[model samples]
Structures are given as C-alpha cells and as structure tokens.
Target chain A: MAALGFAALFNVPARCLPIIFLFGAVGIFVKLLLLLFGINIVFACLAGAAAIGFLSIPAAHYKHAPPLIFYIPAVIPMVPGIMAYRMMLGLIKLTESTQTLNYNTVLFETVNNGLKVLFILISLSVGVIVPMLLMRKESIKHVRVPFSKK
Target chain B: MDQAIKSVRREEMKQLGKVLLKAGTMLMSAGANTGRIRNTINRIASAFDYSVELHISQRALSLTIMDEEESSFVSKLRRTPPHVINFTILSGISKMSWNIVQDNWSSEQILADLERLEKMPHYHRWMVLSLVGLAGAGFCALANGSPMDLLFTFLASFLGLFVRQEAVKANFNPYLAIYFAALTASLIAGGAVKLGLGHADSYAFVTSVLFLIPGVPLINSFSDIIDGNIQNGITRGVNALVISFSIALGIFTSTFIYQFQ
Candidate 1:
C-alpha cells in the first residue's frame, strides 16, 4: 500500500526513474524503521527526511530541478493520510450522535482518533522541519560569494 | 560588453529592485539552498555589472551592489543601463559550482550528514505522522467505517494542490478555491460511501488535511526564527497558521453544509 502511494506520487513527466525508485525504496524503509523502533512519529518523519536529503546528494549533483521532488515523494509515506481521514470520520460521527443515536461509543472513538491525528500531524511537521532547520544552519555559513566584485 | 545602456529614473530603478526582491524571495521560498541562492544573486548582480556583496543570515540574504549607477531592470519592459553583461554567464557558472560540490563530497560524508540529521528532533514528527496516517486507515477499517471515504480523502488531498496550482493564475481567491476543492472531495467520498464502493467515513477527517498540511512553511518559519529572521519567520509562521485554519475551515464548512442538507 505504501509503495503504491509512493508510485502514484511520481506522476511527473521527465523525472529520472532510477532516482525515483531509489527514493521510493528509502521512503518505505524509513516508514518501516518508524514502525520497528516504536519511536514518536516525528522522529520517523525526521529519519525519512534525512534519508531523502542524503539520497538527494546524487540528484543535486546531476543539476536536475531542486531536491524537493526527491525528498517530497520520499516523505509521502509519512503524510497524515489515514489520520486525517479518521479525524473527519470521527467529527462526522460526533455530529451524528446528537440525534439520540446512542453514540457514546462512537463519540469516544471519535475523540480518541481525533487526538491521535492531531498529535501525528504535529509530530510529522516537527520531524520534517527540524532537520531542515539544522541543514539551513550548516549551509548558511557556506553561502558566501567567494569573489564579491565590489 | 561595449555599449552602456542608458540609465533609467530612480523610481524605475526602485521598481527593478522590488522585482529582484520578489524574485529572491520566491527562489528562497522555493527551497533553493543558500549556495544556489548566493550564486543566483551574484549572477543577477553581475548581469548589470554591479559588484555584489552578500550578507547571509538565518532569516534572509541581503545583497548590496557597489556600483550604484548601474540601473537595475527586473521587468522585461523596463529600459536599463547598458553594462558589460557578463553576469548571465556567471549565474550559469554558479549553478555549475553546486554540481561540482556535490561531486567532490564523498559518499561517506553524505552518509554522515544523514546520520547526524537522524538525531534531530524534527525527524520524529514526520515518522509519527506517517505511522498515524497508515495505521489510522487500518484502524478505521477495523472500526467499520467506510473505506471509500479513506480512499477519496487520500486521493483528494494528494491532488488538491495541483488543482489549486492551476486555479491560482485564473483566480487567486484562496477561500473560494479551497472551498470548491473541499466540496469536490466530499462529493467523491460521499458518493463512494452511498454507492457502497468502500468505507465512507473511516479516515476522511485525517486524510482531508494532507494537502493542507503546513509542514514546509512551518519548518521554514521555524528555521527563519532560529536563524535570526524574526520578522520574516514570524510572518511565515503566521501564514502557516492561517493556512491551517483555512484547511480546518474548508473541512468544517464542507461537512456542515453536507450534513445540514
């Protein structure tokens, strides 16, 4: 299922297949590591980002478009797809419970799922952003123009 | 290289400055790394025969030209000073320099960087989101919610940005844009559920916001703040917040309207 999603993400024209496949595999592996470590979702996401970023070194060398595509798709497995869906369902179910449907069970489930989804999204964002921030820091000093014609 | 283009008015020059500013902002936001960014700025500076001095901070990259007399021309219609336009070639060379760096760096160094990145706090967040998203789907199925809802939500969220990208040129109405998109997505999910095509209500909520997730902007803003671009970072942070609210609004509005009817 994750592979299918990753495959679908590469719907762009003229992208390098080998790079796409490499990133795709790395993306899934990152997800698997997340599952294996039982770590916070955010860490898993960061792991995925790191993987994508490292893989992008080759793409960066090739002078193709920026590494976003390579990293973005590599991180697709980490997207909050199911959590978002569950939250929507939970909200809808909560609304439905107002009409004497005896939906206490549904309400409990909804709240639990919603909270989980929220945490997941927060974690995902943090995971992806933190490393990027660090990378930015490392790269900032190196951004100097060697010969300022001034 | 020989004929100097006539100088334009100060106002015209300012306009060109604005254009260049916008371009730089766009390029930075588009995720061009600092090296590429400096090279780009230098290239632009050299094009006008203006010597470029770049000041790099966490928040922004500031460029000052030593040659003030070289009239800047960012727009195509504007008339600019004729100078030795060697900067165009320089810009291309700067890009090539990145390739050179990538080639020179050992695979071991790249791997080390990746290892270092793995230890950062933020990476955990992405993993959590992915786990929850994938796990949520299975949980939804077990809970007896509509699977079709999950499918549509996934599909819609993935494609929503592309739709918005197309609509941006014709109509920049963000509210209308997202609203319509939400409705279209809901219709797909709702229809699938009604038809018994798949589980309808299972993972729709969590999935709906996939496209609307402000991961990039949030990170950029946070980085900006950490890098000392407080104003710009705060502005971006607020924008990300607003976008999050917008996604919530779109979902709330769509669901309310659908349920009410």
Candidate 2:
C-alpha cells in the first residue's frame, strides 16, 4: 500500500502498481528480517534495496519499462523519513537549548540522526544501482509486452 | 540526381533528429535518469541504422545523430520540459522504442506514437490524493503511531496534498507548493497535538509531512553522481535540498506557533 501510494503519486503506469507493491513489501520484509537478526541498519537497508533492484530487472524486461520505473518508487518507502524528521526536530531543539549540557545532548542527538539518515540513503542508492552495474548485459534484453499486438 | 538524393536524405535525418530530441526531452522531464534517456534514445536510433551521442544536462538535451558512414549528421539542442514524475511516459516510451526497433518503424510513425504517448492520462486526482494520504498513514503506522495518530496523519496528508495540487494549479512555484503542503500538513497535525487528541501527536506531525519528501530526486542525485553525471547530480541534489529546507521551514513555523499558544 505504501508503494502503491508512491507509485500513484509519481504517476507510475497503472500496470506497474502491483509489481511495485510486491517489491516494496519484499524490501521492507527483508529489512525487518535482517533487523530481527541484529544486522546493522545500514546494511539491512542496502540488502533490501538490492533485493528490489534485482527484482526490477526481470520485471522491467517483462514489462518493457526501464528498471528505474520499478525500483525508484519501491525504494522510497525505506527512505528513513522518521529519522530525518527526528534529526530536523533535534536541530530545532538544539537551537532552543540554553544550558551547555542540554545543547550538547541535543547536538549529539541531531548529529546521530543526521548521520544515520545519510548512511542509510547512501546504502539504499548504492544497493539499487549495483545490480544494474553488475548485470548490465542482462538488463538490455529485448522485451515484448505479452498481451500487446504490434 | 545526386543532389536531390542528398537533399532527401538530409530531410530524413532532420526529421529523425527532431523525433529523438522530442523523446529525450520527454523522458528527461518525466524524471528519467540520464542513463535511461541515453540508452533508450540510442536504441531507437540504432533501429534506423544510425547512432546518437547525447549530452544531457539538468534541463536540456543536446543530441547529435550520425549515419553508418558518418558522412553527414544532424545535431540539435532542445530544452527539457519541466520535471514531473511520470513513469507512465517513461514506460510508454521504453515500450514504444522497442516496438520501433522490432517493427522497423519510420520516423513519422515514431512521431505519431510519441504524440499518443504524450496524451496518456494520469490516475484521477482524488485517487492520488487519498492514496497518498493513506500512504502517510501507513508510514505513521510503521513508526508505531497510535490509531489516533494514523487518523490524524491521513487527514493531514489528504488535505495537505490537496493544497499542494491546488497550489500547483494556481501557478505557484513548485517549491512553494511543497512549502504550502508542508505547512498545511504540519498545521493540522500540530493542531491535533495541541488538542491532545492522539497519543502520538508528534508521530502524526512527523509522518503527515513525510509524503512531501523528494525521495526520487535525492536518490536520482546519488545515482547520477555515481554514474559520472556530476553536474546533473549536483543540480538535483541542490533542488532536493531546497525542497527539504522549505518543508522544514513550514513545519518549524507551525511548531513555533503552537508551542507558544
């Protein structure tokens, strides 16, 4: 549902929505499963994004659309929005802090959240693109939409 | 006879160049990354026994198309249309390009197809708004927001996206539309916080505006830079930054008002 919403918001072709939903669900499930196993959050995010990127190749080949149209919307749900929100809020709080101790605490919290957001974003982007890099030859196969005639 | 044939060939090259430029600009403005644009266009050109070199920037595309012999070429530059995330067009063109190659389409046929692709309709406005609102609620749920927080997020984001659509229709700058949407979402969520209606008011406040995050542009920026499209990457990055700043400002404004009240 989250992926569908983003796919719609981005005006993704109607036909691609279900696939995006599947990929999105798969990504989140992977991230959560890895988290359950005590994996680092950044690595977890990278794994999830890589899963989506790999899924996108066959999907894109079948659908005759670029892999980006598939993976971009799916990856969005894992974008660490809450962390960024906390970082921004922490920044706001830091500005309002008076005492040195309070300022230091807020500053630390802000930086931590900010760095996490940064690393997660990097991992997600790199994860999505790595498959394309590794399988560039496979990604370029000709596609024919199964139901379409000429 | 030779002069006439040369003239006719040049005309065909010009027409093909125009078609390629139009397609490239459409893909670029529709939020396709640099590599896809170049690859798709190149694939289409190759079907016509020609090849192309594309120079893509943030808002423009420069294309040079050459025949097999490289005796003559057609070069043209066109400004990309405003960026709107329309994967339908991206998908449509991708499919159409492959079809062109397979069917051996003429430049005229490709132009006709491009025209048809341009007119494809988006999902209905209300559906998009409601679904995006629900998406915000979903995000809130993922964040462990309370049920009341989910309701607040849904309502806030629904109205916020509505405001954004209307603001865009009113010809407001795109960043300004985002600012307005953020302000609307935050204001509604902030009001709920003040009213003490939700156990996770802050969650609602944060997640309601999550819909406005420019996730695609930011991610595309990273991809672009990694692909060595540094100028385009930096431009998109800065664009996303400005948008984030706008969102933060709007949220901050509402938070300041409600905190004092």
Candidate 3:
C-alpha cells in the first residue's frame, strides 16, 4: 500500500491516490492468498491482476478517468527488479567462468530468472485485459446512453 | 449538386480529422498504451458521427475519417516521439476524450480545453523529486528491509533523483541521465555497504534505482503486442529493453569499480 502511495504521488492525481493505493494492497493480498492455496506463481499473478482490474473499474467511473490511469502506477511495486538484476548478474558470471560444466548452472539460473519475470508480466497483463474486455463490451451496448459518475 | 455536397462533406471531414489527430498525438506523447489510443479515437469519431480508420506505427500515426454522409473522407499523418509520460497532461486528455465522447462540446470548445491543458503546470519539481524518493523508500520496505534501510534508501534515492534531474536539466540524453543517477545512488549505497552502515540490506541500494526503470514502455509493449499491434509493440519493446540494458550496464560498472577498491 505504501508502495502504491509513493507511485501515486509520482504520477497520479491527488484525488485518485487513495483508490489506487487500495487496489495495490488488495491485489497483492489476492496474490498471497492464491500462493497460500498452492497456486502456481503464474496463476497467482493472474489473480492479482484480475483483482486490481476489477477494483479499478468503479474507481475509474468515480474519478472520471480511465482505469489504466490508475492500474499501471499501482502495479509498479511488483515489477521484478531484483529478478532482472539477478538475471544480468548470472549471465555475466556465466560468461566469465572458464569451466563449462560449472557455468551451466549460472546459465540455467539466468534463463529461469528471466522466464519468471516474463510469466508474471504476462499474467498481470492478460488477467487485467480479460475484465477490461468484458467492461468494454458492456460500454458499447450503451453507445447512445449518457454516462454517469456512478 | 452532388459534387458540391461532396466538397462540403470533405471540409467537415478535414475539420474533424484535425481534432482527432491532435488528440491521438497528445495521448501518444503522454504515454497512452496502443489500445487506449485507438479506442479513444474510435470513441471520439463515433460520437461525432464518423467512423475512422487508424494506423499507428513506432514513429507516426495516420487516420482516415469518413463523414456521416459517407460522401468524402480526410486523412491525416503525424510524426510522433514516444515522449516521457506525465499524468497531469494525461488526465486532462482523458477528461477531454470523455467529454468528446459524451458529445457535450463543440470542436472549438474542445480545442480551447486542450489549449488550457497543454499549458497547465504539473506538480512542483521539488515535490516530484521527493515523491520519487519516497517511492524508492517504499520499495525498500516492500523488499522487506528494516526501518533503517528504509531511511537509507530514502536519502540515497533523494540524492539520486537530484543528480538525475540535474543531468536532464543540462540536456543530457535520457539514458545517460539514468546511468548517472544509478551510478550516483548505488555508489553511495555501495559506500554504505563497504562501511557496513546500519542493518540495511543490500537490496535497498537497488531500490534507489527502481524509480528510473522503464515501467511504462515495458507495460505498453506487451499491451500493444497482445492487441496485435506488432510493429509498435516491437518498437516499444526494443526501446524498453535498451533502457533496461542501460541500467544493468550502469549497475555493473559501479559494482565493478567497487570491486577494484
């Protein structure tokens, strides 16, 4: 939540901060809950994304802003900075090591780290889009209808 | 009579196309994802009784707008740079797009609104810098660091941002700014590590650099690709990867120098 607040202060409107903060905290909780139930790491990320995506819809209506205005900033905290760094570090180490057999572990670790980051990203984006697609279809049905802050 | 009617329709198409083109460019400049940019233009066109054909690439946008009478069309082209994201301008444009979609205003009013928005001041620079530092500290806590580590991360990131802003103010390249900022931040944190200051974890050092990562480009890259915007997606993705590579290179250099000491 504090991470979300920090992000909101950087790129979001003051009035929309609280909702963005809430979306992130709850989204991470959803991820944790899925993990507790033995869900795969990729599935856990998907659940987290869906959680925020669902939460942001009503908030977007209230703020009269697009859901993405909040969604992207809120998700910043979860970006795998350490994993990416480790991937780079491992690759460098693999290159410097003269022993081919021992360096293979470094290569494996680098690829594994990169893959993990990729999967989490894929899950987050795909999960969020699923709800957005449904919502967009609903909006089109009411093309001539007047919009409300509600 | 038919020829006269077609010319009049063409004029309307041109007028509408100009406005729509401007909106698309603004959204792209403000870092809107590919999908949102396309949809916003579509919404605006539908509201105005035109259905538009749009083609967005890495460096340009083209739109063909057909008027309600279907008698004529106007096409527009704009060269674009994927400029840095600013939420204030983005929010203004978002509101304007909604208003346009709602059919609540005329072209004149929308352009006036856009004019004001382009001139609107964003948050104070010092405040933005502080908040960016705060974000780094928050990442420290998020990384499971101790309170001391959080404080250390805050101060390090604060100074890091100052150096970055200075580099930017001096008109250094964006990637260069990131490099200087990372080197400055991680160097300080590295000094702390050498001296074994506090109980702060080494993780806090990396948190100082997090604020400079290419979050928008990465997210937009995937979104564009998933939406089948292959060209723009690949462009954005490569752009992001380059920045990421820059950051990694910066960190590697700093750590490499530290090894010699």
TM-score per model over all chains:
0.57, 0.95, 0.90
lDDT tens per residue, model 3, B54-164: 998767789999876666677899887547576666777877777776655666777778778767766677777777777788777777877767777777778888898
Q: Order the numbered candidates by TM-score, best leading.
A: 2, 3, 1
What are the clash counts of all predictions, listed in order?
38, 0, 0
Count: clashes, candidate 2: 0
Candidates 1 and 2 compared: the better one by lDDT is: 2
Ranking by DockQ: 2, 3, 1
Better of 1 and 3 by DockQ: 3
- Model 1 chain A: lowest-lDDT 10 consecutive positions: A4-13
Which residue pairs overlap in candidate 3's backbone? Answer: none
Runs of candidate 1 with Cα error greater than 4 angstroms are A1-13, A16-21, A84-150, B1-39, B42-64, B67-172, B204-209, B212-215, B257-261
lDDT of 1 by residue, B182-243 (tens): 55555454445545565434245445445444544555555455656576567667766676
Over the stretch A1-150, how does candidate 1's per-residue lDDT look in tens digits? Answer: 332233233232233435655675675578668868897655675666666766665474374444444554455446555555555556666775675555777777777767766665455444444554556545434443443334
Model 3, position B226, has a per-residue lDDT of 79
Model 3, position A100, has a per-residue lDDT of 82
Arrange candidates by lDDT, descending.
2, 3, 1
